[model samples]
Target chain A: MLTGWGRTSPTAATLCAVHDEADVVDAVGAATPERGILARGLGRSYGDSAQDAGGIVLDMTTMSGFTRDGSTLRAQAGASLDDVLRAIVPEGYFVPVTPGTRFVTVGGATAADIHGKNHHVEGSFGAHVRRMRVVTGTGEVVECAPGSDAFAATVGGMGLTGVITEAQVDLLPIATSRMRVDTERHADLDALMAAMTQGDHQYRYSVAWVDSLSPAGRGVLTRGDHASLADLPAGTDDPLAYDPRPRLGAPPWMPSGALNRASTRAFNEAWFRRAPRERRGEITSIPAFFHPLDGVRHWNRVYGPRGFLQYQFVVPDDASALVGLALQRLREAGAPSFLTVLKRFGPGHDAPLSFPMQGWTLAADIPARIPALRDVLDALDGEVIAAGGRHYLAKDSRMSAQTLSAGYPQLARWRAMRDALDPRGVFASDQARRLGLTLGSAP
Target chain B: MINAVGQAQSVLVLGGGSEIAGAILRALPAARLQRVVLAGRRSSVMEERAAELRGRGIADVETVDFDARDTASHGAIIDAAFDAGDIDIVLLAFGVLGDQEALESDPAAAVDLVTANYVGAVSVGLHVARRLRQQGHGRLVVLSSVAGDRARRANYIYGSSKAGLDAFAQGLGDALAGSGASVLVVRPGFVRTTMTQGMSEAPFATDADAVAAIVVAALAKGRETVYAPAVLRPVMAAIKALPRGVFRRLPG
Candidate 1:
């Protein structure tokens, strides 16, 4: 049984670990229309994007390696950002873009077209990729680069076009593996949005943690940039030394309601109160500043057996008020959200299915078992779509096909291009089947 | 594909005319369901049922002729349903509810009822299980009556047949444990349907929709077995624990 990060809607798939390009070709070649094939990375997508029921799932993590030539790194698609960072950080380089977690593989990152806190300044991960080698549904290897139709479809195509085997990515140079951070607390959603809209341009990275349970949507905003050697203490040793290890592992089991309203509300309250009202230029480790939750292994388990759903949507700057309205709806529905994040996105790239746009994006984690959560989200989906926004497919586990079509107007063009590349409809995932991304019969 | 939210896209009903199965199909989200396959003996009722599902907004609706007593044809019937596509749910809703007095007086009629309920279910159940196992994921919902819990004197012939079916379904569920395919045995109390139209209302009698709602909820929770009108669970326990002499003395 395989499920995505959300641990929901698990389905059985014949897992085939591909060690090289040949194995990927063999796997794709063996796929039939009845049970199609899908390429799986580290399975970081929160929904069913990585799984295919009664089909072949090519596990691409076994083929992993990378080589750097100056600022450009030619890396295997299966190489994770975590592994990439470990190898390149000491050499004064970092991935151009990373999502909330570093466990995602290059192939998964490109397929999802993930964006990071630096999105307002830099585009999504696809923008940083110079070129890629993909094994199409017909078992043919093709090289695609920027401005190519293949590249546009392959990136954020949700692996429907083909299996990405390798990518040439432009790396970001870093002086040290530390971040120069600035922190501030906002009393309400308006303040946070104003501060982000006005001052986000000055920082390389920015994100806000909002208290969904709070009536005012209180939040803590953090912004940072790579720390130069002069910014670090003179006595610091091995400034580029980078090693991130999980400090704690969640217990084997947690009760279904362990993260209920009472517990999460208190946790959110304490977390909000702990942040400084305003603190500037505090030196911090890259892992600490970027992925604090990564320090806790299997942190998602804390949500319990029913798992959780991450509802993330991007609305244009003109419709940013929907963010506050969503929070208010969640609060009114009595749904307890453990984590809520707000970010600003720069202009989206050429990838038709890519999620990012010049807009305001908000993501929240709510327990899947909550009775009121589905209706609340459905209502939010209508408003979000009406506001000219779309949901992040990487984080979605339950959005409908109508919502997908309404959110992504380019779906028809993407489908046409995808069908051209794979006429047999060999590449399929549960998410693809659920959202009608492919023309094949629903599985 | 059944999504994380428990919305199934495809369903195959083994008994097209079964009221309980129709209720369950209607209770599901019609807009999300892409296909509905009703397998039963050919008749206008089957076509009308298909038309009804299509009218409800289900895009694809098809029917195949299926005879419960034709054990030799069971494999083909199951293959026909699966060959169309991967079925997310299979409703095993075919059975005979013979009149107790007439069945008891005529041994041949009693044997026929047993053949239809027990023997026929075994044939189709095994065939469906094989397909589900090969597919690696699907739910087979077996509609077992609460009478199967114990064979009372009033309707022992029909009750015993259902008892055999319930046991077969339970064992089948165990066999599919780690195969990612499993069975859900739904034991509903006296449900007011065409089959039970003329009978006097049994205590705690429920409607087909109520049983359907319970089954849907149980399937969502991944339950192996459930009693419709859930109160029947405790009530059945008391009935099963009664002394044999007292149980036989109780009115039908």
Candidate 2:
């Protein structure tokens, strides 16, 4: 049995820990006809994309190691972004793209085609892949580079086409591990959106944490760029130091309803108040600047046994107002979303099922213990779909098949390619089955 | 799988026709429970239940034969269930609440009740616990009763059997403390199920749905033990403190 990061929608599968390409192929070959298979990274997908109920799940975390060559790096499917960063940061290099956390594996980033705060400038993780090795449904190992059918299908393919064995990625050059950050507080969503739209181009990374509990959609906005050697104070000897450790961990057990509306609102208010009205060029470590939440282990447990859901969606730039509308709906519904993350996406890649596009994306984490959590999210999904926005598949756990189909118009094409690669549907997952990605339509 | 909101995608009810288990599954948010497996000795009844769930839009509904008396095959049955896919909850609801008078007269009947309710539950509970531990997560729901809280003269045999089951379940839960798996012991006083249809309604008697509601809520809270009709907690407390002579004077 396996579950995604959201800790919801658990499914049972025959978990096989694969140490290398050979093990993955053997596990794939051993899959029964009645049950399909899927590969799992660090189980950070937030949903069921990496799990196949009653099927086979290749635990690829053990199949990890990496080799770097100047600006290019080759890594196993399970090599985490954190692992690569630790190996390369001291050498004055960084991964081309990283999501909110560095705990995600290289293969997962490739499969999800993940994007980071710098997406407005650097594009998604897929854009930096030089080539990759994949174990196909037929148990054949093949190397695919960008522009190839296999490459396109495997990228953002959600692990349906084959088991990603390894990949070569292009790295970004950086002079220091520190990020020169700028922070500002906004009283309304409109002001924050305007600020980001007009000035975000000046920085490499930009994101806003909206106060969803507030009626005005108030927020704290931050923009950052990789610090150069000159940006560091004279006393700083190692600007490239990259050490990340959890400061604390939520206890395993907690009473349900621990994070109610009152507590969440108080937290949001305090967090917003702590941020400076305007600060610039403040040097912060890489983890502090980009993956602050990563410093706390098992933080999801704070939501109690019900855990929490990450509802993320992206709409075209013109429909940016939908973000505020969605936030207002959550506020009106008293959903008590603990956090609201807002980001801008540049042009999306060619992966048919890739989540992002040239748009505005907002992600909210709502504790599932809320009685109306599901209803509120369903309502938000309708509003998002109506606004021509789509939910991020990587973060979705409860969206209906129809909503998924409506969001990703190219799903049919992606399914066609998946079918062509695995005619027997040997590579499938709960998410795939739920959305009917391999079954033609919603089941 | 258990979801972020205490919703499970799949459930396996060992006692497929158990109204309490059925109600528990039904009370859960329909969108969260996509699959259900009703495993019991009665295939036709399980199939009927599965059909009803299927009609309600549950994606997958299956039936498997599970006889509590078949203790030797418990491991295989558990393995088959997990093989079917990750079962989020294993509901141990099978038990024979034999007639106290009949069991008093027939030693064989008394032994049968003990075997099915206590010995059999222990065997299967251990099997399910092993599988859940191997999976590194899941829930084992044992249907105990307030009778287990004390062996009463009205139903001492049944009460004793449940008492044994309850103790064993709690111990198993403790053994699994850090394994990401846990056990839930549900003690419903007098549930109005088909099993207890002809019995007089006891004080604070509740229906299967009511007990099911409490069980769902308790599971969400990650509770180790719960007494249905909640009022029973205070009532049971007072009863447990009564003198032996006074307790014996209570009617069946």
lDDT tens digits, residue span A1-443, model 2: 46788776555677788988988888877765455788999888887788776677888899889999989989999999888888899989999898889999999999999999989998889999999999888788989999888898889889988999999999989999999999999999899999999998999999999998989889999999999899999989788888988899888998768888889989999999999999989999999988898988987778766667888999999898898888887787777876799999899988888888999999998776676776778778888898888998788777877788899888888877777677656887877766666765211
lDDT of 2 at A299: 78
lDDT of 1 by residue, A1-443 (tens): 88888887777889998899999988888888776899999988998999887789888999888899999999888999999999999999999998889999999999999999999999999999999999987899999999988999999998999999999999999999999999999999899999999999999999999999999989999999999999999999998999999899999799889998999889999999899999999999988988888898898898888787899999999999999999999889887886899999999987899999999999998877775666678889999999999999999998889999999998888888888788788898888877877854222
Q: Please tell me the interface RMSD, in Å, for model 1.
A: 1.8
lDDT string, candidate 2, B101-134, tens digits: 9899999999999999999999999889878866
Kept native contacts, as fractions per model, are 0.45, 0.18
CA lDDT of A97 in candidate 2? 91
What's the fnat for candidate 1, on a 0 to 1 scale?
0.45
The list of candidate 2 runs beyond 4 A from truth reads A1-3, A6-19, A30-38, A47-63, A175-178, A227-263, A280-285, A304-306, A332-338, A419-443, B10-22, B34-140, B160-183, B193-199, B231-246
